[model samples]
Target: MNKKLLLICALISIAAAVGYYFSKGPERISVTQYKVAQGEVKASIANTRVGTVKACRRAYLAPAIGGNVAQLYVKEGDKVKSQQLLLKVWNDDLTAQLILHKAQIKANQATAKQFCEIAAGTERDSQRLSRLKKYDRIISEEQLDRAATKARADRAQCQAAQVAIEIARAKLEIVNTDIERTLVRAPFDGTVAEINAELGEYVTPSPPGIPTLPPIDLLDISCLYVSAPIDEVDAPQVKVGMSACVSLDAFAKKRCSGTVSRIAPYVLEKEKQARTVEVEVKLSDAKDLQELLPGYSADIEVLLASKEKALRVPTEAVLENNQVLLITADGVLEQRQFKPGLANWNFIEVLSGLKEGDALVLSVGREGVEPGAYVRVEE
Candidate 1:
């Protein structure tokens, strides 16, 4: 009877040990989580590739008539005003021609004065002879006729001299125009970005269909814009006057506000690139544009829609089928499907099936994180 009791107790002890081992439950997987909250969510699009920060007005300046650079009034980084002289090509011959024309005009004016005086004297003599012949018979008809003919001829000579003056003035204008063609002036208020020609350097006009470097590069930094390429699908949604934000690679922490100013009417088809349409965004903030420079690599985000106070979550936390994982009060992973509204690269709006203060699993890719699995949330 003692042996039987000991065996029964041993059997019960073994069974209890097995039950305890099986009841311990699955191990908890460590995970990171984000609590649901109310914040701003925006729907937007960005450039498909890198974009360029460009000036609103940029001019590649060169003299219309090629010649040796005579004077350089501006150097790189010099600020200039509209119509200010930036450079002058060699125009000594033109200037000399201008001076000659002026001198010729003066000479013609003097000649005109002398001829007119002679004409006036001849007319007076003709009148006197006419009166003498008619009344006193002191002057003969031949003398009167000769005096009248001399008067008419002198008047004609005087008119010809006056015409010569006008011709000289016209010639002077032509020389002045030629001189202007040899000069390079700023088309608008800007800073000189580059100067390819130096004093005494001979610069030539670009040949037709072949572009060459201009002698001067002028950029209006006061007004700036970003030119970026957007995918063809997104281009149709973009319109002029839409709000935008510009981020440059050089200024990582700064973002400038802008508005869409233009969109290309056609798409660009490149062999290696996706079909894209060019878009321009004008920077609206004067203070933010002070540090921006042309040629800086940039990116642009055009806002399409937004929700100011939407329940949102980090975009990375959302999983397949618009679902997100959350830890229940009992510490088990729960997959919940939600309706999403506005979404961007950073955040997504939660429309339904999620509430504020619910901690969503951010580390959805972590091992052992799935529906019904126990998780240990990281603080």
Candidate 2:
């Protein structure tokens, strides 16, 4: 009886050991996977905002006449109108020279009048000579010749005086123009985008290259635009007149509305040695914020394509190259792959990798996640 009892105890111990071994089986990672089905993927590219705010305006605000910067009335942000005085260059020298020209013009006018009077007197005398010759009176032929010579000299003098007066007048006009140009004025009602010359700074018209005298760059921000680059593949999809929205880092919370103003008929040579096409978006005035200065950069959302009830999925749901890991009913992870389609900011259109009611990991960051892992599904 004792031997039989000992054998029974040993059998019980072996059974318990076997149960424990099965419970502690080989380690397996727990993860969630989705069955291959449909989903969505949004495609976008980062781009900078750029556009010409105004056309045919002065970018380099250079004067036709050069002079020292006497007064810089406007800085970078001052508002100005057409013909408004924006700055003033030194005009003392120009002013003094103009005064001299005015005097010269006056003297020339007087000289012209004097010659005219003398010519009039000579004409009267000539008339007398003609009457005397006609009547064959006691008028000497030598006296008639003297009158003719005097009249001829007087007429020539008058003509010369008139020419001199005109020259002086022209000189005065030129000097006055130079002095007026000294007061640089705004060509349009726009903000002073820049100020190249400082107070007491010497400015010149001729640029000598390198250290060359600079012209102030002013921007007319009455109308702003977003200049974005579409990828070569998507370039065909963009067209002029398409509506778009612009966002920027300067004003992240604000979104500006715009339309595709122009699409270049030709592709520009890649700047920075990369291939790119410049697309222009003209923003509506309603979207203009104080921050939207000329050359202000932004990200543009163009309506390339859209759908009402399109198939889509979270970007996290898809894996490499149409491949996804699907968890079967038995909680076993299975590999799946499929084609993809259009994607927005959050969701992507899965052409095939998933199905409805499928459980897929929301992120690749899931712990213990990989193919063949055992996963327990949760919300």
Candidate 3:
């Protein structure tokens, strides 16, 4: 009986030892670790926006007067200079009228000359008759009066003919102006973007109720800009002349430098959405702008602040209340509070309680990882 009792006591002791070992838990937990490094850190506001490449000058060219398109001097993609003739409407009728009026002016001028000659002869006759009547009374008073009256009438006819010449000239000028209206000219140096009307197509004036196609679309692409919308929260920090980096999805690797040109004074609101402000960015380098075209989907990063050679860590490494789980040299976790300065989405600048080459605990939510917990760094 004593031997059996001693065997039971030994078995209980062995079971208790096993329970105590299991209560101690696993020796170490696998955790991801990050090394603190000195690098460049930037605080920026980034947003993806659909942007349109706009020219400094754009126009839809149309004629003031409606007529059949007589001639087209340019097509789409043609470069043009200011005042260059682009299109001409039919001006046959105006040309004919101008010619007729010019002929009338010449004819009227000849009639005026003939009337002036007649008036001069009559005036000479009137003067001689007055002198003869005064010297010898050979001419009757009635005859002298009749000569004077005929001279005056001839002079009036000459004046009327001269006025008629002026009227004809004025009519010719009006027709010439109408003919000029039939021709369309470029207002500025630009490229022809679209040609809505072809030669011989009738173009009507853009009236209130009538829809008419523009004869040509002109765009001056020498200077380009982008119109992008920014969130209202970040709009205050953005100001004119702020440097920005722009990238297009079409050119994935290429980036263009730009400056903030304009910021809207009012916020733009969408249906059940956050308010945004429109901003305009002007491309700075002309060389970099050569390959960029209008209407590209672009994303921009507006640099707000930056620090060079800043001691930084992955932003995820920092936990709530500005505390970071730092790993000691002995592979133990220590929750340490840090003062962070300039930070971005990827990195946070550690202002205090961290050093370059220090190992930082990155995985925060893993089980059995707490203060004073032993951790094994994952390779």
Candidate 4:
């Protein structure tokens, strides 16, 4: 009886051990999977620093010769053409001076005409006197000499009067220029951004030792660009003519295409913490930019390289040594080496050893995620 009991206990212990062994089988790794796809793989660099939308040309306009603002032809937000008269300062005194100079020129011209007439008369008299002396020897030699002297004197007086007329004309031109200086004209085709002075208000120019407010602000928005700073380390990869995409905070939904127009030769030291280089990007489609204004905040993404229809996977799926863990047909992880092409922060291009429709492991550092380990895909 004791032997049978012992045998039953041994059988029960063996069955329990077998059941525990089967229940606690190999661990199954819970993993997320990615489906490889054929798409564009692009390597790009992005700047987090806020960029500025700048016009090709901007000006703070003020009168060259300052005085009370007499006329304002343009208001804020008015579009103007190059060389269009935009404003005028008080120039009554300058206008009066111009008129006075013109009258003086006219008077001088009249005097010149009178002097020329006198000269002609004196020359005729001199010729007549000389002819009489030669033919009849009646006129005295001294009288002929006096007539010739009078002719030369009158000619000199006429020349002097003509010179006076030229001087008066020059004075008139100077006054005309002064009057023109009192009028402010647009320097380029642009929109008026600001107007600081009202009619009858005094508008002064910027003095050498003092700062003054400008009467108007003009901005040429025909061509707009974004000035963004690139990290000095990434600056070497950036080149002029590279394609880029820009987004403005004001126009959040719209992204504008652009090309790299300029790259700074040297690094900028504006911030003490980081050294950066400025790059200017010109908008490819500037027509839509008309609605945008200068000084808007912008961001830029510069494309370094791109590949179309390439085999790509999420960047997190690629492990160190260019190895990727791909799920095999039996749902087991298999570590395979792949050749990498263009790679950015989010995705990487697989040059070889991968194809479309392949499944890849997406989880990072999960336990039981080694090679040959079975995985349960999370739906």
Candidate 5:
């Protein structure tokens, strides 16, 4: 009887050991967690591809009539005003022509004055002869007729001289137009970004239907904007005057605030690339405008809608079906379903089934992070 009782006791001890081992539970996982809080949530869209920082006004300048570059008034990085002379092609011939036209005009004016004086004297003589013939008959009819013919001829010569003066003036105007064609002027206030010709170098205007490098590149850095492309799916949500943020790859720390200024009327369909619509965002009053330049790589985020002081969760913390893995006070993972409102890449608005001050598992992809599993929140 004592041996049988001891055997029963041994089996009972083995059973208790097995139960203790089995009840120890699954292994605990260390995971990152985010505490729910009231914050701003935005519905925004970002560029699908890289965008560019562009000037509000950029101009590629070249002379209308090409010739040897006679003078370069501006160098790269020179600030210029509207109508400021930038360059002048070789125009010594045109200048000479202009001087000749001026001289011809002066000469024609002098000749016109001389001829008009002669015409005035001739008319007086003809009037005296006509009075003598009509009232006193002191001159022969043939002599009076000859006098009238001379007066008429003088008057016609005077008119011809005046027309000659006008012709000379018209020639002067033509010369001036040609001279302007050889000169390049700033179309707006900007900085000279490039100069393709030096003194005495031949520069040719671009032929029709063929593009060539411009002699000067002007950029209006005082006003700058960013042009980016968003996927066609997100294009409809963007509109003019919407607030936006611009980020330049060169200025990583700065996010220049801007607004939607324009949207392209058509979508771009590039081979092997997703269809995208071009959008332009203009800076309102950026203090860093001076530092930006055209052609700088940039990205933009257009805010479609925003909610302030809303129950928000890190977007990554939310899982499939609007669910999130919440960390219970006892360090156990609990799955909770919530209705979401506005969402963005950074945060999501929690419309229901959540509250401020709740802890959620941020690293939901970690092993053993399933609901009902024990968790150790990483400090």
Candidate 6:
């Protein structure tokens, strides 16, 4: 019985030695590890939301007067300069009114001339009054009185004809003005966005019921904007004149540069997250830019900030409550808790609980491993 007990003890000692050899004894990770270094780490919040690229100022071009669209000189995507003729209206009525007013003015001028001629002759005779010059001894007082009365009536008739001419001219001017307005011109330099009317199409005015006229819309794409409604929680960090980078799904490979131009004063409710405030971003290169539509699907990233030098560690290495397993000088694994700062998916800033020259673990799967646990460093 004594010899059997001795053999069993020897077997137990050999098994214990084998187990210790495999576990590598004193505390060390079975995987390769990197030394904690003091370096910079960035705290970034990325949003996977989409937005649109729009113009800073858009326009809706419409005709001043309503009429049948007699002709359209421009179409969609046509570039136009300020005061350039855009479309025309049927101006027959307005033209006719101008002609009639001109005729009336001519007639009134002729009548006024006739009355002036008659009045002049009478005034000349009155002025030459050699017989009436003999005080109280006129050759024919009745004749003199008739001459004076006729001259006065002629002068009055001439004045009335002059007034009639003025009225007719004013009427003609009004109609002429309307006729000139029939040719619609671009109020500014822009591109014709939509042709709401075609040739001979009876397009009505916006005021409604006035009459049918040329209809169209124009917009200026010289400068564009991307209005983003950033959440109120993130808005306070956003400021005017901050730089931004933008990408579009349509132009997936292209990148657009811009800056924050404005921010809304008040917050508004949004369904996806919480209340948000509107932000306007001004594109840097909008002049002569092509392929960017007024409303295009976009992905925007605003650079809030960056850190050049920060202490960083792999996020996977951190355990619960920001605890870290650090290898000690005595080759034992020690439990450590650190204060965490800004972090991304793979890395976090080590605010505390770690020092330079300390080794870090790749993962926290040390279930059987505890504080002061024996371990071996993997090659």
Could you give the C-alpha RMSD of every candidate to the true structure, in order shown? Answer: 3.2, 4.8, 4.4, 3.5, 2.7, 5.7
Best by lDDT: 1
Candidate 3: tens digits of C-alpha lDDT, residues 217-323: 89988888878788888889998888887877787664547888888889888735778888888888877688877666777777788999999999888888788
Candidate 4 at residue 183, lDDT? 92
Tens digit per residue, CA lDDT, model 5, 1-379: 9999999999999999989988986568999999999989999999999999888899999999879998899889999999999999988999999999999999999999999999999989999998888787668989888888999999999999999999999999999999999999999999998888888888988898999899999998889888999999999999999999888878766564788999999999985658999999988776757588889999999999998888999999989999999899888999999999999999999989998899999999887779999998889
- Clash pairs, model 6 backbone: 26-375, 27-375, 28-375, 39-310, 40-309, 40-310, 67-212, 67-213
Q: Write the per-residue lDDT of candidate 2 for residues 288-312, one digit (tens) a residue.
A: 6456666555677776655555566
Per-candidate clashes come to 0, 21, 0, 0, 0, 8
- Residue range 66-109, candidate 4, lDDT tens digits: 79999999899999999999999999998999889988989999
Arranged by lDDT with the best first, the candidates are 1, 5, 4, 3, 6, 2
Ranking by TM-score: 5, 1, 4, 3, 2, 6
lDDT of 4 at 180: 86
* Model 5 misplacement above 4 A: 1-16, 140-142, 328-332
Local distance difference test, candidate 3: 0.86
Per-residue alpha-carbon lDDT of candidate 1 for residues 211-249, written as tens digits (9 for 90 to 100): 999999999988889999999988988989999998888
Residue-level lDDT for 20 in candidate 3:
92
TM-scores across all candidates? 0.88, 0.74, 0.77, 0.85, 0.90, 0.69
How would you encode candidate 6's per-residue C-alpha lDDT over 29-90 as one tens digit per residue? 46446678766665533333466788665666566676788878888889999988888889
- The list of candidate 6 runs beyond 4 A from truth reads 1-49, 119-121, 130-136, 139-153, 180-182, 206-215, 252-257, 269-273, 286-291, 299-379
Q: Point to the candidate with the largest TM-score.
A: 5
Q: Show model 2 residue runs off by greater than 4 Å.
A: 1-45, 48-68, 131-153, 193-198, 204-208, 211-217, 227-238, 254-256, 262-279, 288-290, 293-297, 327-331, 351-359
Where model 3 places Cα greater than 4 Å from the true spot, the runs are 1-32, 115-166, 205-213, 254-256, 270-272, 316-323, 332-337, 362-374
Error of 2 at 261 (Å): 4.0
lDDT of candidate 5? 0.91
